[model samples]
Structures are given as structure tokens and as C-alpha cells.
Target chain A: MSVHVAPLKTYIYVFLALMFFTVLTVGVAFVNFAHHAPKGIGNVLNDAVAMSIALTKAVLVVAFFMHVKGSTKITPVVIWGTLIFMVILFVFTGADYLTRPMTTFVPVMSQ
Target chain B: MSENSTLAHHFDSYAQQKESASLGMWVFISQEIMFFGGLFLAYTIYRWRFPEAFAYSSNELDIGLGLFNTIVLIGSSLTMALAVRNAALGEKNGTVRNLILTMLLGSVFLVVKGFEYAHKWQHHLIPGPNFQFSGPDPVHAQLFFVLYFSMTGLHALHMIVGLGILAWLTAQAAKGRFTPENHNYVEGVGLYWHFVDIIWIFLFPLLYLFGRHHLT
Candidate 1:
């Protein structure tokens, strides 16, 4: 059987997935898995969860709304061109944040 | 319109014209993503330094409103897509109706968001100048509010612009300007509107709903 798909159906699928994501995000937020998890998990689990959810949503938006899903080579190339520059920017700036030498001022204790 | 003298007399054919317009809009959307990327980066750095405070500040935000707004924007995005589809199918009336719905939905988002901001302002929830909420580390709390406002405020501005485009498109549709062979505006506007929705998708959880348990 030759199966045919409509664009609206695809959009509806995406919309439902987004609704699911909303629940997942809210639920993940209430869970005590992050470093600051309402005094529960002492690790960075919560942060990890939050970041993961965010990344998923970002990917979905880019793939669908931007029409990168089932896209041709030329379009992907254009998107990647911009992404390359963005990545380069993030790299240098992020490295600066992590590598800055911290000097403890420690108010001089005068005898 | 025939391909000989009807392809806008500019492009080789209608298909080429449509593809080029879509490509151009995609490029514009990429730049927008990068624009918001800057704020998200700042938010990450600050969140790392003051995780607890970010969590605290996030909880105070109305998560329900944020979630609801997400739905509204998503629905608008769909309507925008329908506008493009109608334009491609030579359905002038469908295009106008869809554009109106899309634009109205965008306005609803702004109105709802305005109410939220008003509530925040009344509570002195905005960062700086008598930020009333106190409980968590005050400095970190303030950082959260700063990020919240910057992210959401920029989003609201985009919504306003999207409404403008939608309005223009609605007017053009009323004049019967779009048909199967001519819907560049509809396609372009759809791409822009969808991009705005995408930005909010990322911002919603990051700004309004993250780090929940920690605060309560």
C-alpha cells in the first residue's frame, strides 16, 4: 500500500510532542535531582535535567519550524554556516569564563 | 499564470521564486536564533554561579502562564503555516482568515504576557529598583529576575513585530494579493512567526519553569 502523509498531520504531531515536553519540563523541575533540588540531591542532577530538556526543545524547534527536517543540502549548508560562527563565538567566550584565574583578595590581616 | 510571462517576470519559474523566498526567510531565522543565543549563554553562566537563586526566582514566575503562552504561540505557528498552505493553493479567503487567526493568537499572547508583567511589577518582581522578593541569596535572586526580564522582554518585542507582519499580510490578503502562484509574503511571514515561537519554546522552561523543587 502506498502511504501518503499530509503536512498538517506532521504539524499536529509536532504540536502534541511539544505539549508532552511541557509536562516533562514541569515535572523535571519539581523533582529533587538537581544540586539545588529543594535540599534533596546534593549533586548537579537537577541542572543536568533542565539543560537536557532545553536542548531537546531547541532541537525540535530548529528541525521543524526552521524546516531543517527533511531539508535539502543547500538549506542545511546555510544553517550550518551560521551555526559554525556561533560555535566559534561560544568556544572562545566559554573558555574565558572557565579559565580566568581567581585571586583571593582575603582582607590583609594586620597585626 | 503561465511560466512564460507570469513567473513574477523575475524568477525563472514560480517554483524557483518560492524556493528562493523560503531560503531567504530561513537565513533570517538563523540570525534571530543567534541573537537570542547570546542571552541564553549569559543565562547559563549566571545560573551556574547562583543555581539556588535562579531556582528561587523561577518558581516565583507564573509557570502556568508560561506554559499557556507556549500553547498559544504554538497554535499561532500552525495558523501561520496554514496561511502559507492556503496561499500556495490559491485560496485567497483562506489565507486572510488564517492570517487573522494567527495574528489574533499572537496578540493574545502579548495581552496575557502583559498581565503577567503587570503582576510582577506590582510585586516589585522586576530586577533592580526595589525588587521586593527576598528569601534566597538576594544577589542570585536578582540575577534570576534579570535573566527572566531580558529573555521575556525580547520575546515580547518579537511578538509585537510578528503581529505587525501578520497585520500587513492580512491586509494584503484582503486585497486578494496572494494565490497559488504568489504567496511570498505568506511564506516569509510564516517562517518568521514560527521562529519566534521556537525562541519561546526554549525560553519557557529555561526562564519560568526550571529549578522548581529547590525553591518550594
Candidate 2:
């Protein structure tokens, strides 16, 4: 089978995009998303934005730099399966943690 | 079947062999994702539990250096991609040059990380008996540092391993061991390198960029 060698320009373009996203994530960090929204909601928004940019960068590296875009069909299947499991790991664990009641115990000395 | 000396007898053609290799590499990478995924899940849960402590501890980290290393790692990924391309094109010298460049960037990242770790050490933030945090919640803050060191430490270990592979690839590349149709090793290493970079891509934001707006 003939290998599909990506053009030199494609790597350059993807590199530039990754760099741009890196800077954008940093810049977004300094912004007070909380001030624009309710106190708690603002913090959530900040984290959401930061994670979104990171996910974008990860996708770019996986697709172009790692050549997943040009790889065999089975490759994506493996990746997606891994991702599904990861989601389960996070969601189920997070659900348990978020639902647990906060209880503090105080020990008393006998008189 | 193709009579290519590099082609394994179990494969019918070079293409099938290459596909199998790529699939194997992806499978390995998927397991790696799960390995790191556990740590990420722990991080998410703890950060959710102690947002203030996590943010406070995160603020203590040097974002400037973190950002610099992020760029350096991404730059290395580019060189690694170029190296794979060169190897696939049967350009031995180009492959070696790009691989060496990638190693240089990877080393720079490690050096910066070493400095960061040392800084944390000197500041009494290594999360041990001597660990100290001036924040309101020192215990929770220490938990953040625990996750910080573990996650980034694992990532650094991966970088060191990737560098070792690149060094070997460079030696082989210099000896003209790779050709256009027989560069599966180079491509596999490239995927590993890029996977490491992707881990850092998520790690930088989660660890260093947490609650920066509060500091501002």
C-alpha cells in the first residue's frame, strides 16, 4: 500500500493553529468570567472555556500531528471506544462525589 | 508476499503490515489514555470538592513557564511529524535532522519542568512532611499539589521515554535503515510522541490555568 505523506504545509498550518489556541487559552484565563455572570456560574464558565480550548488543541494534534485523519478506519474505532470508557469513568465517579452529603464528625472526650 | 525483505511473512503486503502496526500503536495509545484518564478523573473530583484550594494552589505555579513549555511541546510535535514525513519520503538526513530537533525541544521542556519542580521544592510545596501552604485550607491545597506532581511527573516520564525512542530512531535514521515503504517504526514513534503532547495539552490548562481570573 502506498503511504499517504501529508504535505509539509499541513504540519505548519496545524502547528500554527495549536500555538494560537495555546495563547487564546492563556488569555482567556485572565478574564473574569465571574464578573460577567453570577458568582458560581462565572467560575464554571471559566473552567468550561479553558477545557474547551484544550480539547480543541488535543483534537488538532491527534488528527494532524498524529495522522489519525489519514490512518486506517480501525484506528478511529479504537480511539472512540477509549473515549467512551473515559466518559463513563468520569461521569459515574463524578455523580457519586457530587451526590454525597457533606458530613463532619466531632469526637467527644468522656467526662 | 510482496517479496519485500522488511515485510513480515504473516502479512500479505506492505500495506497490511503497516495497517496492523498502526492499529497496534493506537491500541497501546488507547490504554495509555485510560491510564491517564484515571488521574484526570481524580483531579476533576478533587477540584470540584475544593475549588478554592485548588485554585489557590494552582495560582502558586508559574504560568509563564507553563505556557512556554506548552509551546515547546507543540513545537516538538511538529518536528516529530516532519520527521515521520521525511522518513516516509526516504530522506534519511532530513529524518535525522527533524528527529534531533524534536529531541532538543523535548529536552527544553524537561529542563523547564525541572526548574518548576525545584521551585516547588524550595517553596515547601512538595506535599510531604515539610509541605507548607499559607492558604486557608492547607490540607486540601496539599492535595492539589499531590495531583499536580503525580500528573506532571508521569507526563515527564513519558517525555523521557519518547526522547529515548527518538534517539534510537535518529541513530537508525543516520545509518539509512529506513526507507519510504519500511518506516513503520518511525511512524509508531511519531504517534507516541504526539499522544504525549496531547496529554500536556490538557494538563496545562487543568493544572496551571485554574482560576487565574481570581488572581487578576
Q: Pick the candidate with the highest lDDT.
A: 2
Estimate, for each residue in B1-216, the C-alpha lDDT of model 2 and write its tens digit.
Answer: 346488877888778888898899999999999999999998988888788889899999999999999999999999999999999999989999999999999999999999999999999998767888888677778789989999999999999999998999899999998888789999999999999999999999999998788878
Q: Which candidate leads in TM-score? A: 2
Tens-digit per-residue lDDT, B121-179, candidate 1? 99888766577776667656877787788888998999998888788879988888776
Interface RMSD of each: 6.3, 4.1
* Clash count of each predicted structure: 3, 0
For candidate 1 chain B, which ten residues in a row score worst on lDDT?
A: B1-10
**How accurate locally is residue B208 in candidate 2, as Cα lDDT from 0 to 100?**
93
lDDT of 2 by residue, A1-111 (tens): 466888999999999999999999999999988889976677689889998999999999888888789777898899999999999999898888778974522212111
Poorest 10 consecutive residues by lDDT, candidate 1 chain A: A102-111
lDDT digits (tens) for residues A2-100 of candidate 1: 211136677677767877887788877777764444654555775567668767866776676556675567778887887897787778778887788
**Which runs in model 1 stand beyond 4 Å of their true positions?**
A1-5, A34-44, A61-66, A101-111, B1-6
Report the Cα lDDT for residue B150, model 2.
96
Each candidate's fnat:
0.41, 0.88
